[model samples]
Target chain A: MPNAFSRIEDLETTVVILSELAAAHEAEKALLARVACCRYSDAATFAIKLALEEGMNNAIKHGNKFDADKTVELVYDISEDRAIITITDQGCGFNPSAVPDPTVDENLEKPTGRGVMLMHAYMDEVAYNATGNQVRMVKRNT
Target chain B: MESSGDLVLDVRQQGSAIIVRLVGAVGMTEATLLGRQLDELVQQPGAVVVLDIEHLDFICSSGLGALINAQAKARPYEGQVRLARPCPLVMRLLETTRLTNLFDVYASVDEAVAG
Candidate 1:
């Protein structure tokens, strides 16, 4: 079977955790360590860190609604050239296009909607599965 | 001074402004604590809250939300929240979110206190 993350040299790391912010934090720490080991530029590291945080937060909070029974899955491949990550949740997904633009004048003050915007801004590429339960973000070393 | 996991908050008074120095990361877990603390600070009469972020290593959207919420809460009271010494990473986020115009930003905590 062809691996989805075969392009990156490193073996992909997969993590599954209950829909808890604490567990997500742990997963993030481990993944960030891997990113650091790859020696990505400081700017690239910052971008990846911000996007990863937003992606995991959305999966655990918005997607799973913090339901203890629900789980969030994270998969990542980190190489010197780029880092690719996917976060999936065990809840009904919503359309990304339906999210209101946070940059709009009226919505700028609203805080909750900026997560998705930040993910898009910091990542080189962001794509969601058809069901919207999974998000894949890529940050290329620059 | 208050600490929650990776985030530390040190609040001090500088003239009429209340300066809160944040250190470490402010992700999802730390945002709750930051929001609550900012809420309490903004409730003071004519409060001027200055955030010293020189040492803040990281912040996510939730943390930005907390800042916006504090600013909103202070508006009715003729109070405001000012940001000081944002690191490069944080500056990029402020610029990306177009929040640079929404909040008064300064190069130093002293400037924020005076502004």
Candidate 2:
């Protein structure tokens, strides 16, 4: 199975953005703009967009607190069997283990707290690296 | 770039299933396109629908909502809708929502069509 996976295909350029006051919608937009080249079903495309937006949204609002100087790094690695994408931020690391479950009935209407959950649900793998400053996710080529 | 606008929806009919191939972003803007397509299918009975999004790059919650909605609409008629070949980024969203198991994922349109 490992042999079937190929080296990460680097994106043409890193998509980086600086937002202010916890508004990272631009970053989310930028992230989505880059993912527009993926080979997925409409549902999957929506899932990826949601993940990217949610990731960027959390990075901006919760992590960096919307500091303009705090930039978000969006990297895309496209390959034949899979795409390895990573979202990194300059904010202080946090505890990924501390996130709450969003699927519970009471939490269903919450605007947030569901990004990580959703990411894990949609992607094949979702992992945290560098003490929570980075989120690396994988989507198989299936 | 607006990733949520201008999605191209193409429906290709195979034996007993319809392949709904979407190209571009499946964001808020294009979510409705999915709804419209599914609505058209709702009127037709007994045909499975497989959504093909390999050409799509980005997906949002609203977009996923549309799929869920379509699936729900199909359930009553004994017809099912499945997802075909989602991109990495798109897959990430499904995993995040824990919705990977909600819909059957296919490796290709042929596999889905054959099933």
Candidate 3:
């Protein structure tokens, strides 16, 4: 824990429901409006929204595991020419790099593995920090 | 602000193509589920399919990927996928990825079904 969190226009919100279905939709609306209001083109807004939804959904389902008591903190911020999204889960984290490559051969047939791939594709940068429980993603501010 | 997911899929005997009418947020979960259904449809002759998304609420890359994957699967059989009635969100996704040109998008399910 740091003494002070800086550089993030952070709004800490929690999703504590077990349904795990509408998490992305809820977060995406706010992100989309923010992106659109920032004078971003419709395409850029959609791309960022898509990427953020995937990241949040993963945080809730895999990172939080539908535990109602647990919370997923969503942070939205912008600096210079970049839009940043950070989602932190309170559950146990895993090896982010260990996930199989969905674009490679022998894995396309798998159905449940493309979320991270889509996040990487839509966002400018996708990286996991603090042992994979914290995902920090950015999309170019257009 | 409003989200709904009531999909009505009407199948037309178009020698090959099947049109799926989407009526909700075509997000990751539904996209994953649709992948299975579209997977089964691609095995048929000609392998072409059309998606009517006029009533679509939202679509992320996951949903877009499902559509692209369905199209790719159909291509081996000389079949293709078409789009119809893309809502604002759907259109945004397409235009963002520059996929609007990849598939033939129509304005209505009838057009897609007839195509």
Candidate 4:
């Protein structure tokens, strides 16, 4: 999918906060509440919640390198059909392609590097900007 | 030790196995605490760690990472981290990550402790 914010123009709710896990968690709670309010199934809510957590962790830890001074931006929209979320960090982005496949035999035991992979697995669509700092994920209600 | 939010870890010893009952969700913030707790438990010789996750409602990649870290730490001492009583969501996560074979999963706390 295209990384076009215009496509989700109706998703005007934007939240910008510090690069901290606590803050990101608050944002996640609020977004998940909206997903629930949209009447998504239990499984769909779980999937969205999981994907959101992984995306936020990547933005805060990998993208911003846990820089307290930096901030993470979250833009989201929830409807009966789908939930779309975009997370952007304020640090130099890395290459998403460079991340190893965590599902592989040798990498399965690795502790980290599974955030992006899980986001893709759970979400219907996952796309990153050219800089790889910003990620947009979508989950269909079905 | 219990965290302020999301996750609570209740650690107790059952025979040779150290059982950590995970209650609530384990997200990025809780994973650090989980990792530290597991690290300490696996220090014992031939430590067998059983994670009771019946009350665990949510877990993300970071939480899974903590479990993997514990398993890796336990391997050196011939220790192991086994999972027991995982909810459906957590089980789906394990299956999706293809980690079912990586960790021994039991149907109950008693079975895991005995195994």
* Predicted model with the maximum TM-score: 1
True contacts kept of 2: 0.25
i-RMSD per candidate, Å: 0.8, 6.3, 4.8, 0.9
Assign candidate 3 its CAPRI class. acceptable
Model 3 per-residue lDDT tens digits across residues A1-142: 2533543435333433342656655666766676666787665676676777777777777888878777777777754366878878877887866778755546544445467766777788888886788888888875
Candidate 4 on A21-60: residue-level lDDT in tens? 8899899889988887899988888889998999889889
By summed lDDT, the worst window of 10 consecutive residues in model 4 chain B runs over B1-10
What is candidate 1's CAPRI-style docking category based on DockQ? Answer: high
Give DockQ for candidates 1 onward, in order: 0.83, 0.13, 0.24, 0.82
Error of 2 at A119 (Å): 8.1
Given candidate 2, what's the lDDT at residue B85?
91
Model 3 CA deviation exceeding 4 Å by range: A1-7, A10-19, A78-80, B1-3, B6-16, B23-25, B32-48, B52-58, B61-115
Residue B82 error for model 3, in Å? Answer: 7.4
Best by lDDT: 1
| lDDT (Cα, 0-100) at B67 in candidate 2 | 75
Model 2 stretches astray by more than 4 angstroms: A1-142, B1-4
Candidate 1 off by > 4 Å: A1-10
DockQ of 1: 0.83
Mind giving the per-residue lDDT tens digits that candidate 2 earns over B1-115? 1223457778777887888888876654466677777867855676699889798776666567677777777777877888889887666556656666667788898887776
Tens-digit per-residue lDDT, B1-115, candidate 1: 9999899999999998999999999999999999999999999779999999999978999899999999999999899999999999899889999898789899998899889
Please report the TM-score between candidate 4 and the true structure. Answer: 0.94
Instruction: For model 1, state the Cα shift of residue A127 in Å.
Output: 0.4
Error of 2 at B84 (Å): 1.3
